[model samples]
Target: MPKLKTRKAAKKRYKTIGGKRFIRRKAFKGHLLEKKSPKQKKNLAKPVIVSKQDTKAIRIMLVC
Candidate 1:
């Protein structure tokens, strides 16, 4: 059987916890921060857990 390759882009975007699940950065914080409130920016910095519906596909990309 051929080896299943890991998707490099996905590798960079998602992080795993104990090889069981994934966490990812929240969107909308990438740019244009001046208009956003300090509290909103602070909350955006925190990582969010991948939704169960999306976890299956991400796991495949992660090859976890």
Candidate 2:
């Protein structure tokens, strides 16, 4: 049988920690400090867990 290839797209977008999946928040691109509010900017610096409904699909994509 051929080796199962990992999904490159998923590998780039998602990260696995302690068997849980996390994805970085979108927006705040370039992280310019001249506009976005402190709270919004600080919040975007964190990683958020992928929802349970989406976990299955993400795992498939990640081959994890």
* Per-prediction TM-score to the true structure, in the order listed: 0.90, 0.71
lDDT score for residue 26 of model 2: 61
State the local distance difference test value for candidate 2: 0.76
**Compared with the true structure, what per-residue lDDT tens digits does model 2 show for residues 18-59?**
787566456555657768888877787777877888888888
Top lDDT: which candidate number?
1
Per-residue lDDT of 1-64 in model 1, one digit per residue for the tens?
9978999999999999867778999999999999999999999999998888999999988787
Candidate 2 weakest lDDT stretch, 10 residues:
22-31
Whole-model lDDT values for every prediction: 0.92, 0.76
Candidate 1 yields a Cα-based lDDT of 0.92
Off by over 4 Å in 2: 1-3, 31-33
Query: Which lDDT value does model 2 have at 44?
Result: 77
